[model samples]
Target chain A: MSVDVHLAFPPLARIGDPLERVSTPALILDLDAFDANVGAMAAMAKKAGVALRPHAKAHKSSAISQRQLEAGAVGICCQKLTEVYPFVRAGIRNVHISNEFVGADKVAMAIELARHITLSICVDHVQQVRDIGAAADAAGVTIAVLPEVDIGQGRCGVASEEQLAALADAIAAHPGLRFGGLQAYHGGIQHVAEWDQRRVAAARSADKAAAYVRFLEARGLPCPVVTGGGTGTVEFDAASGVFTELQPGSYIFLDGHYGSSEWLGGFRPRHGLFIASTVMSTAKPGMAVCDVGLKGVAVDSGLPRVHGAAAADLRYTAANDEHGILHLVDAQQPDRLGERLLLIPGHCDPTCNLHDQFVCVRDGVVEALWAIDARGLSQ
Target chain B: MSVDVHLAFPPLARIGDPLERVSTPALILDLDAFDANVGAMAAMAKKAGVALRPHAKAHKSSAISQRQLEAGAVGICCQKLTEVYPFVRAGIRNVHISNEFVGADKVAMAIELARHITLSICVDHVQQVRDIGAAADAAGVTIAVLPEVDIGQGRCGVASEEQLAALADAIAAHPGLRFGGLQAYHGGIQHVAEWDQRRVAAARSADKAAAYVRFLEARGLPCPVVTGGGTGTVEFDAASGVFTELQPGSYIFLDGHYGSSEWLGGFRPRHGLFIASTVMSTAKPGMAVCDVGLKGVAVDSGLPRVHGAAAADLRYTAANDEHGILHLVDAQQPDRLGERLLLIPGHCDPTCNLHDQFVCVRDGVVEALWAIDARGLSQ
Candidate 1:
């Protein structure tokens, strides 16, 4: 079913002076690393002969998506329909919403957006497909609908081949819905501590998804695409010959959690993202205060790690609303009051969501700033 | 000292349609209840015979601060100087930055801002005070400087009266800086879980702060303002006769953590904030999927608690970037797909920071939506 689009008017402007104007606790993007990260991901996908569908949820900026497309990405994957609008509003042609939408209002919004963009959305249930079909019918549009299959995360998607086939048949039966393929993403393996375990999990996940595709082929149902794979397991999935497109997002902005993972295989791409913060206070001997805290970086993946400060053996500990506590691990103190400290956030995605702009710097000079245009416009 | 005025541009136009919008991971504010909360706090301060300096770190909205000022708040206390900009830009004249700012850029920015508003900022170090004085001099502004004393939180601020007095003396010695008052905020007591212990901790904190105030009085230093207290200990500090003004931010948007805590003395203030999320999948028996996950609500105070849906014994357990896992504890089979659930975030401040708009509803109907205009404007 064609997805309806909601227009957030004034179309988000590219943040001009994101770093200079955004106050403390705002998200800052390093332009140099961000460009390199995007280029490297595209190059990796191209080398593997796989399609690159960069996930918009990582940065949620239409400008960034445009840049990705210019760099030869096939399409962009959106987490939500509401998140798809800014991209479509920016005239993005191909979009895939990698989640399910059930409500009439939400489906209607998606279908509306589909009018201007090549839209596809994932559905795990037949009821959701019927709803999407009805919405697409009302909107006078035919939409590509993919039945998501659960590999391991067990969040959405059909649990088995039988359920997946049934959902695909239901979508095929619907008038306005066209069977797109399958969304097979293993979210649980993203942070697997060991590389071998992560590869095994990815292979197992791909095997499950491949079984569904084989079933669809036997039934003669058109399954044109198979999309999935995040940054953590994208390479593994690409090499497994199961995924048609790779959606590795955080490769563009390597977070502390990703950079310091125990997975010692091929996951350590590079240090691609860093938050520039200032030492606000130094009242205690063993602790220093920073401007970034819970408001700056998400700690769900764990606390941010200190970066580029050679003198201090400091670790980011407790965080209040505005201030971050840096616990001194070694005797060397942190930069005194007024010194700028670069921080590697625990999680890149949510940390990117916290900032309105990213201050891109390279080789000790500010290059550019990217506005996380869709920073908090979650539906 | 004249402050540099930073005028905020008019708010972005209402981006999306309100009525047809599906409610999921949406911030909902009850305007009527919010006004009542402001009035209730004002009345509480009046009864205690202390001025109310409502903290802006919670709402971070000038619209809310205007109501606080109209009700009875003498001023607004911002956690940081950057937080002061939005309010100052909105023309909320009196602002006290409770957090310490010790950078060349930040101090200069503070002094620049002091040029247009009645600005006061906290200082934790003698060197910080000196820097502030120098910045004020450069900006040609005489700024009110408050010495911050650590009562218990051990984050930022002077640990003892001697340090506090010395910082005050340092500020007083500078021509551009005026020793305005003392800032003694104990952040640890704000979420103490239990009632009696929280009260005791708060009382101890107040006692320690009062002793410092008395010491300052003995030293012949005029302490014009003794501001400190949060939603958890506003009453204790007000009754302790130490603080001339109470600064409570989260009271306006009462969160689940505060509601779960017994420390606030068993009174349900009926505050405005809530997060509305939608059920995405119910594939697993006794477990439901929601759109509001780690990205929707801040989980630091603990996971968001289910509210308004009695049928589902729902509790947010695990959250991903785009999904929330609701573990149903009581219902035999809870939460059908597409169900709307109202959630009380574990922490309201950071949760609010995650949204771009507050879908204000009254009587079960979405009435007005306001942009969290400065949601991620934090630099």
Candidate 2:
């Protein structure tokens, strides 16, 4: 729905203003915390001798992607071909679709995108590779093809080493398609809850990646690169010799789900992302409602925690489409209507997709405004 | 995030095209079904002597709102003040915000909008009334204020008639505001599953609303209108004389959750809304993935059901951010990549909010494209 520019409330606050002045249900990015997380991630990847190919799907902001690239990220990983346009348009090169591209239309889209910048995509089935190769050939563009192996996330990707070899053969046969090693990652393993469980899961996933690499190399098709690791598994993945690159999207904007995991063992990253919400209605003494809900943030991971409200026990118990229900967890601290509260989203990815722009605040002052450039580009 | 006109992909199809030609992850509105649903709702409400104030929060499309108004329905209800702008901008005079408005900025915005359109809003606290009254006074506008009483949904509403009377008195104290009616809705009761349960819930909710009316009237504070009913409870609500107006937004779009309920036993509304997704990856015969997931459609209530694939047992098993996993339930029917499949969302309201535009189709051909004019205006 298009709105008149005058009526639309884009930036919640002006530059050099405090966070309290920002409007309700606005996405807030703590720049100081964000930069620190970025630096930490960059340093970890550099020491591990692995390129940090940050997933743009996390922030979906080209501004954040620019900063990541500036901080030694090899490239940005995109989930959809349409998502690549924003980051690549902002002058970032080496765009990789970590997910599979299906159908002729979407493959053609990927082929078209390859014309502008260096593009790579994952594939499990040979038919998908054939379609991609044909499109790339038609468009006179070369696309690096990564055959994704199922590293235990029972979703997409090939199950065996033989299937991986077959996909590699399919890619080599096509003139326009180049074989670009393995795309292996256990998506569900990132949020295993238990630290020990995550470590075991990450180690097992790396073992699978290593097995895929060894099998491909012995079969005379030397795997050029092995890319796969999320925020939770990146450190464990670094110890494994197979992976040359890591894809950690949520490291910059840590969420409640990640905060639960002991994956960030020693490095306690600050909460970089928050939903700035104002109490809209106080119907009773013990209850209050905020102007942020299922539409403003996400609830798939779980209900978000009230950020920085240490004095009060204010838990986000429930959410409707446009309202978040808050209960007085601690009767000592009372909530006043119109007072602002910061929320840590249950999941950072989908929450970012819900908003159009992100307010960058630093030292209690609105530093900048960043557009979530690839907000709904899930084509 | 705003994109260049050339790069935007909001509309998946043009006019005079087949359903199969429409883009994947596109919102589809079967016009024949939509018109039939609208006619059915209007006829039912007309016979019941209760006006149908269709909730705009469901469709969020001015086109659909216009069609509903033309079908003998009263003005629609919105969830937010900013959401009211697009509907009003399209020439809808009466805009009722079913949800509470908070903060000075939002109430001021509502007051400004009241200058052009007849505005009605709900309030659960005295502070909310004070805020609205102040803004309306400054703007020189009269706002119809409804005191919200919680019948069942423990979100944002007054607990008792005494509290509601206090709010009404506060509204009467302000010259800029007028006492509208009682905002009583047991939101979750509408989807109780069993026919008897919904009837009981609806009757109880209506009883509470009737009690509020009597209490207010006894105190010399008359309620002009009593409005609250969703798709599931409208029939029972019609039996109650208290509700002068019914707000059934999702009735036009039959979803999986509603379809499972026995409430609509007599009248099985046609499935109006659909997620027209193409089978992206048929990596294996048993498993196929579609290009629709959390970002494309919501998965809060449950995963969406596959439509028109009865011969094949295709269950939408799981979802990634941009993909839907489908498994062959019957194990007999084969799914091919690029084959189009229609999906009935679990919940219609949030699903409608995810998409920017709805593709209107009639007789297997594209008819018109309608913008979801109030989508993402949850400020």
Candidate 3:
């Protein structure tokens, strides 16, 4: 089966090959920009005196996670249970599932993973704690639990102090479970566009999380860690004085959506990720069709932006399953068939999950092929 | 590396197991509904005196294609070069690449595939014809070439008779190439919503294709085939008298986007595909979160709809990377924790690409596990 996969989707390029040798519709990673982004985030976290646990949900590559760890990241945060396997298999000692999950299969996976490494998971319900805790107890392993509190995202987190306290008590009641911290991630506020508005929103989220922390403290419960923040709010979150750790994923590969936002100051991310596509057809006047589309890149946010100097001449107007319609700004400057173009995806997380491997390039030459180990590990 | 993939994403359930045994966020295929859908489309094409060539880009499964072939499909259509690998490997004799592709790598793949099977591909430019024709000649293999004419889709097809003639002549110039037919697909007209509007759009597309066929006939060119149609326009195209073959993919797995359209009906398709997700979080008052999200389903068409009776009471409001937020219509009827819900995806093609395999179920029991062999074969 593995051989079948490799044969069907062979490596687009060999190491040290020229950029033109790489196949179209392949994920391209600029190593210099990536390293700079990684180092910048690490430096910002160190200066702010907070732990940097870069989320693996963005890149989904164990090799990229290793690089993050080497640059002084404390650990990594995965949004799903199965996403942790690749990192753990690569000898990572710490992992935190930063989302809530329930079911026998999930509980079994949690218990199995806890035996090999320091495993932590988030919960917003008492039943979730019991589900994993009982399985862990039966397996004779301890697991860390973090109760997630809603900080404005309003998706999957506890809404009230009563619910939060009950979840903490539920964790304390289990011998195999320990109260790790609080997850107060507000995913909605991450793309607020305006600098002032985003800053204010991040502050409100931080205040709400601080209030939850105070409630826990007043009830004589230990709140050892307070983890939150993302790429858009990392600067304010690191200085918020409430969050003990930062979980920023997309900072390493700033996409077109993030690029739309105004960045005023510290730790500006670079565009390290791109989808290299080819102009397959120029059949219509002033319009060219590229090979990358919904299957190659995620279009949930919007259509991708043509990168480099061509951005002034070409615009990606629409996407079908396997065809991206590119309209020329100047009809005279038509895109030639087989000409390559780098596309900056509208979203980074889901876009990374669409590919099997990333063609890491340095100085316009292929450097490595990093497998997206957890590409389809949504289970 | 393949073992790593299997370990990280194990089979959700074994054959003959209860549906509850399947893991959350799994692609589910109702075998009964799927079989009915296959039979319906095949019967429709047969009654209309048109050959059926079901597109494999929707399901990406060799097993599904095999079933289509058994149901009387003349051949299968793949939208990409790499996507043809699984069907070819599964002993499929006839395969047509229904989209135009360019590049030396693509030419090489085409020549390699033509050497083993009766391969046919679409082209809109003389350069694309020369590229594949030269490669096929060197390999001493005869390949069928179809020139795609723009029938209002404005994506990847020749817009003028001169360009179409050029492509046809270019194919005839090479001993290894044969002018098989004309391709006139209007993908944009597939989802016109209203019955009359869609009918008119389909008629216009048919008329345009008929004009192209007449043009070819006037020049003494034998247009043996004229293929183009999707699930939404299949009913009209089968009786249009212009197309000799029909290519409808999503009819086997009618999604929310296609379900929203009005069908006056020659053949009504059933919803055979679903994403089985568990309500993992119910901490928020009137809302719940499921495991299937942006990574599990495609949202470019729209958000998925909750399947079955609960759909009237629960709405899938939004999708995060790993969570689908569901809002309850009646606050009293909250979704229970660990409860499974079926989700009809917004789109079928990209949604199928997100999963590795489908859990085929019949009467609430798993019947088989069919691999999505060409899931990410966008190359």
Candidate 4:
């Protein structure tokens, strides 16, 4: 069902120009706020005792990761092997793959990465340990392995102490694998509404992690690292006396969904990333049209919210493949045509995925542009 | 936060010989099914005597659009000017920007596009019309304009005939602008749960569209084209005798959400596109870990469902950035590691947004690999 037909366009546009001048449905990133955000997160992590292992999955860009490292992150955490390749190629030295890998192709890729950097990954089963051993054997290198323990979120990792120990034992038995640490993460706790509730939830999960660490120690295995924590529950994780490292992404470009939550204890969400859009239509009384559609900002967490514009009460109501519908939150005048507006996406990560270059803007002027290096790397 | 770190391979696998060679989290278009789907939609349009103006927002690939034009479509509807640019550059002829253009840059882009192709765009406001006219004047090209009418989806577009007429009159009065037609689209009706309800809803919206067409005709405006209809309501739209052209996308990749909907009474969802993913981990008793995740598939319409290999009732339960938690729908067993599975994404468009290439396969053999040429063109 090919529908390839070209529609012409106006030429190249300069930054800070009205909506008409900029390209339609562009992913715009504010450089000033972004730099400030990086500085702020790094400062916060510096004050905290735990290491800041910045999650690269949020913004899979080597440029962003390099900035994070420069700011003071211990390393970067890549979500997949394919995602890590570009970063490693770009000279990111320390990386933790926060997910499991399966095939020989992926394993080979991971080993290849480890040869250049301090690479580590998580595991939740014995078979994974065996596969790691096999890959490491082929690569002639011992790979560090952390058994992922499911404290909550119900996604992956070992569920019980017995299972965790068994998996760890399997890693110990494998000549090419090392029992590096434990991944005690509660992904669901990050989205909890209340701050205290989130803290308590994190603490409870930490209890399981502590017990698992103890079990491993009793078996004459040293659990040097017990890592886990997201942007949602990092504070609790830092003070929980359980986690050795904290992984939090999205603190840089805090999204509307996460900003709306009261989980982070009064931390004001500094809107760093924004989808710069122009009001395409305002013929309707209470509705306005924008170029940012489903292809612009992600709608998984919800549609992006309009920011610092005349239509302050404007809410993104509906989205098609390429156009977003902004409706008045309160019955006010429709948006003016060609008005430039900044939108805070519902979810930053997926929204970022819809773009290539982060149009970094500073003080209403165009600044540096960062390429999303690891974007769309599915393999 | 980047707590999910996985760098090990699972030992067990259940996929057969050939499929295992395929890449991870790949978007596969079944050529046989895709051809049938295109032919079926074309046949439906031919039978209904309505011109087809398939929306390219769903596929955004020029290759696919060429196929639609070859299938007897009158033209194609693009969602954004940037999206239209690639197709135009590729020499796509007739195009209708089903959405409005706002800024000078975008309007200029739109005007430049008009110079090469018969270009039409939608406007819901007079100011947008003026801006487009200005851009067209600069480009030295005449641009066709359509006033988008809000049929049911409370997005952009005018609500009543009076509003439509005012916008239409404004476009007529503007230099370098022509009153092309009315963009009467019912976006909400596409997901109706019941067949009778969907048909009735389509009829009601069609009536509104017919009224607008009659209103324009009475006012001596050329209303030759009235475009808007999706895969869900194409049948009713073709029979309504109101819309001169149908702009239906998503007919190629019949997703789980569309398949689950009762919007189209007797429409059988041909599984043309499938997210071919591998089972990464199966350590849990009732769950299997998959390579597909929030980064692989769109969950807006709902979670992806298992298409074939029904040994386990697989439902995507949770997702991180790169890993999906597949819950066993049936208690049969967890999927063996590295097993290849076809997942029907919740929404085809967004899921397609996550990948870079469409690996076209015919009868379990590799056919063609089409780069999503226009993917990630957010701006």
Candidate 5:
């Protein structure tokens, strides 16, 4: 009884429609801005002699992932195992999961997916290696296993070289598992909001990860790759000269959280993603109610900003689950009912998760409608 | 390229499976607690002589809506037109939208939905009324139009009595529209925290809405049905003697926001809804990482709380888009990888929107599987 069977209508806009005519709560992607971001990030990785592997969790669209691959990405990064199937089935080759695979069920799925395409998963524990190796051997497929090392994020990854050495040995002992290098990502440093803070964090991360490369080499196991970086600090990670690969996700659809941060040091890509909403009510004097709110976008990073050159003083201050309160801060007149307004989401990752498809637009015409082919596939 | 074509897998559990075997990031609904909540709220409204209309936007599942209807709920309260189709198609006779309909697309959908069953929508302006009336006239169905008044929550709704009268007049003037009294919802008061603060806000709301009823009566437009109240202040609203019906959405699955609020006065229901996640990473000494994160649950209210008899001191503190950080505050040993954990989401409404289905469990076994059929139909 899923609404997908009946929700054939209520789409915000059709192809070849102008921005003002699109329906509210539609995920609109400006191709002009999106292409620039893709090119810039790809070029940055290439100039530093690093293989670019864009994270598909940011967009969740196979078409977007294909575009990134066409732009010289060595592979696509799946945040989890369930997310890998859609991209692989949609013809994306060489999928690398940037996160961990814990249980037997997930390990079995990874082995099954590896039989079709080149599959790689991150691991920081000996048990995970044993579980994945058992499944991969049973399926007769070699799954690349990257041992994660804690650089600075403190969220995940192995904290010490001893643990990394243990995980690598466990992988080497398994027949169907190949030893991939370190997955050292300092996710917290990606949003430091200051240039020096980010640079310092990246230097620390690079030094720690490079030390792991040396540690593994001293034990007769040379680390082949070091994969980690994001939109906020990809430049620093690339310039670190120790990393062999980069995984930057959000650069294709720069959002308010990243746009407002100045830590990237002059690499301000254009904001491409927007949630188009219509003003539903203007009865409360200076405040107007829009259709999209907490359900439409992610607010953990921050509130959505009003997207317009003329809407400088207009603000989206508060939100209920489905309604956003738009305040006419310095305006002389309130926005009329049914007026369409574009909103720049606070964070692109979860905001993209809320959508089923992306209305890809160039100028005022719809170029193509891309399905978020991996939406809701987070395992 | 839609994931729907490939996402036929990854559903957490089937019927009769124990909770321990369910997949990670699954929406788990405890039917026992859910049924108790439904009965409690229904009895509370029955004692106050108020008709109970549970909001479907909370769970977004037609199965739960059917249960509410079977339990003596006066139909269901939908927040938008796209939300109405599923309930009406599923044979729920009456559906009332708690928000306003401004555009032509929504008005047309409302009119179409009205042709099949009873459809009532809220309006604060004459334009909404006129548009609905014209469409209803074309479709040959009378749509019940409820005029919204600003009842402390300064978002949406008309502010003055004169505006309410004007909207009533507009509804009466059209052959396709009918006046259905007032929608006076004081939303801000629901999360006021303190009992006295919520009580004061409810009193103010009741007083203002009662004054409007008298004003409308003196002007020859007698108010009939008054609907507005939520999980936190439903009792206060019921005792006010001004409302004929109550609309509370989140009472069935009490969330972290409502559970922590003392405004409910010791009436803490068992948390019915949970995000069942897997402990993916335990590399750190005292911190555990789960697969559920910002995309898995809403954090506008607060972070999730660990659920289980043994997890008294385990707290879910920080979150990225796809990772929840579980801190072992009191326990010396960290949670092992691949262990299942239940997370009571901060806010139930937006958290329900994240997943496509619900795993209905009872007595440690899955009783049934329900689709979040109305998920993402927020347009």
Candidate 6:
């Protein structure tokens, strides 16, 4: 039987349609706020004299990446190897795999992509270096290798200078591998609530990275680039004089978690991303249920907040697979059925991964639909 | 510029490959366990004399739905209108949208799908009834309407007998709408830890549903089908004598959240679904980072558990965007880099949504790749 074309549903909104015409539970992007965020981050990085490599893991849209490039971003950083394909296909020249990976499949993918683009990847273990280095050598293509140092984030990175040197040496030993620099990213400090605490943490991370750089320099190893920092710590890292590059992903579409944090005066990104949801049910007295839930928005950080609503006015309390329970604090003003509400997702990265495309809107009119090309390219 | 084929990316695993050869952070299905679970649920429903209409929101795979149908399921239940497209395209004749939706797009979709297959939908509001009913009438197709009653889950469904009757009456007013039955699913009680408490909650829900049925019958309305129950409360709901059909979605792939619950005898479903993850980072002592994280698995319920490992031995303590922090309790048995582990996801539905396809494995080898066709069709 022929597959019905309707099964592969059309985009939620057309270009000329109004905001109300867009379907519910859609990932809506405000183009005005987005353009301002892109401009702000680009200008901040240029003034700071630090290369800005926005993490595409947040948006996963090649169109957004192209806009970032046009706004003067150096390159884009992806969290996975497979995630880099879309950007590479979209003509992004410089790409870095921010996380480490193992296995022959990853090595083959690295070699395949390195042939076409300026590819760089991180390594915490010597085995990972040897695996990719060998494949790169066989392919006769040079791949940039950055040894991720565990400055503070204890998840993925080399803990000691000895281990870092070994990984660097392994990369140097291979003919097709080049020592890129040190990756001193501390993901834990990105969401520190207090400004002072987050600044101190970023300073400490920079200090430790400086120490690693000194050790590598003393051993006659050139540390060309010291790339790190996130949306929370970008200001501190850019001013630290230790980090040569800033990798801030969430600044373009500030999520609820990032919005809750106190940012420096120069760089507070606007809330451009939102989940357009409809009040599907108003059954309970103080509760209203919306169509967006775990499937449409990511709740890993916390529950999403209603856009432009005060903390006391409305609160999203619970989320099921396909429903979000909204607690209406104002008893007199009840949410009507079919009433549209914009939800600012708690976390932007994984929330972008949950949707197929973004319904880009400008002045309450749908402007474009950017495909989340790497939505499920987690492998 | 032409889009590269590699940008689309291929499946993580191929048929006839060994399980270890499958790419990391892939959704893996143990076909043996899946067959057993499907057979067990089918046998129980047959013995209980209740129609088995498994929910497709959990799997979202037409291949699995075909298997469920072959195992004697009457039809399938979808959480959204868009989600039914794949199963319908695969020739599943019966479908029930077990949730409420609004908008002209949904009505158009309902009308289009009802033209080809037996389609049933739920509603707690008269507007929804009128919206979909008028469209169905104009299209000259009869769509079954099930007025969802608030059995206990306060998220959706009509609150009172008056509201339920009004919705049913509204459905009857349209020439193309038929009062199929009442939906009395209590989602909150599905995850209750204690079996006794869950049983009591299920019984209460059944009692409330029976009352609504009587009320409707006294008013000369036919309550033909009483469908509501999940994997956690299937046994209780089937034995309650009030529900004519059971809608258990997660039984085919018992997740870590459901596995932690206490189940009655004769109704324990084995964990048939898992995330095949490889340890990518072992930099920190007493800790290992796996490839599966928030993007690969759903952590809304809880963190995924290491399959076949004791709670004290290995624990998935934290989840980042693309990394799972595995806390090694057994000091001597640290997770090695490149080592593969099966992860039982915290919740199956959202976790399944995060993947593109299920790597079906049997006898430690990949048997097939089942596309998660309706994965992001949450509109």
DockQ of each: 0.32, 0.44, 0.54, 0.44, 0.49, 0.58
Cα lDDT for residue A330, candidate 1: 64
lDDT of candidate 1?
Answer: 0.77
Q: List the residue pairs that clash in candidate 2.
A: none
Residue runs of model 5 more than 4 Å from their true location after superposition = A1-10, A263-268, B1-10, B263-268
Candidate number of the best lDDT: 3
The 10-residue segment of model 3 chain A with minimum total lDDT is A1-10
lDDT by residue (tens digit), candidate 6, B78-193: 99978888888788879999999988877888888887888899999898999998898899999999999988887799889889878877987999999999988998898999
lDDT by residue for model 3 over A113-223, one digit each (tens)?
Answer: 787778889999999988888888789889989999999998889989999989989998899999998998999999999999999999999999999999999999868
lDDT of 5 at A236: 86
The Cα local distance difference test for each model comes to 0.77, 0.83, 0.91, 0.77, 0.85, 0.89
Q: What is the lDDT of residue A203 in candidate 4?
A: 88
Candidate 6 wrong stretches, greater than 4 Å? A1-8, A309-312, B1-10, B309-312, B332-335
Can you give the lDDT of residue A210 in candidate 5?
A: 93
TM-score, candidate 3, chain B alone: 0.97
Q: What TM-score does each model's chain B reach against the true chain B?
A: 0.90, 0.95, 0.97, 0.91, 0.95, 0.96
Q: What is the lDDT of residue A330 in candidate 2?
A: 57
Model 4 residue B216 CA deviation (Å) reads 2.5
Candidate 2, true inter-chain contacts retained: 0.44
TM-score of each: 0.92, 0.95, 0.97, 0.90, 0.96, 0.97
- Summarize candidate 5's per-residue lDDT along B197-259 as a digit string, tens digits: 888888888999999889888988777789999888888888899999999999999998888
Query: Residue by residue across B148-173, what tens digits does model 4's lDDT show?
Result: 88887767788777777778877777
- Of the pair 1 and 3, which is ahead by TM-score? 3
Candidate 1 Cα errors over 4 Å, as ranges: A1-28, A262-268, A330-335, B1-22, B263-268, B330-335
Error of 5 at B165 (Å): 1.8
Model 4 residue A72 distance off true place after TM-score fit, in angstroms: 2.1
- lDDT of each residue in A1-379, candidate 2, tens digit only: 2234344433456788788887778899999999999998888889889888999999899999999999999899999877888877777778889987666558667866777678889998888888888877777788899999888877778887678878988998889999988899889898887777878888888888888888987888788889999988888787678789999999998898888776546445678999999888887777778899888988888998898843266778898888888888755555578878999999999899988889899988899999998887777
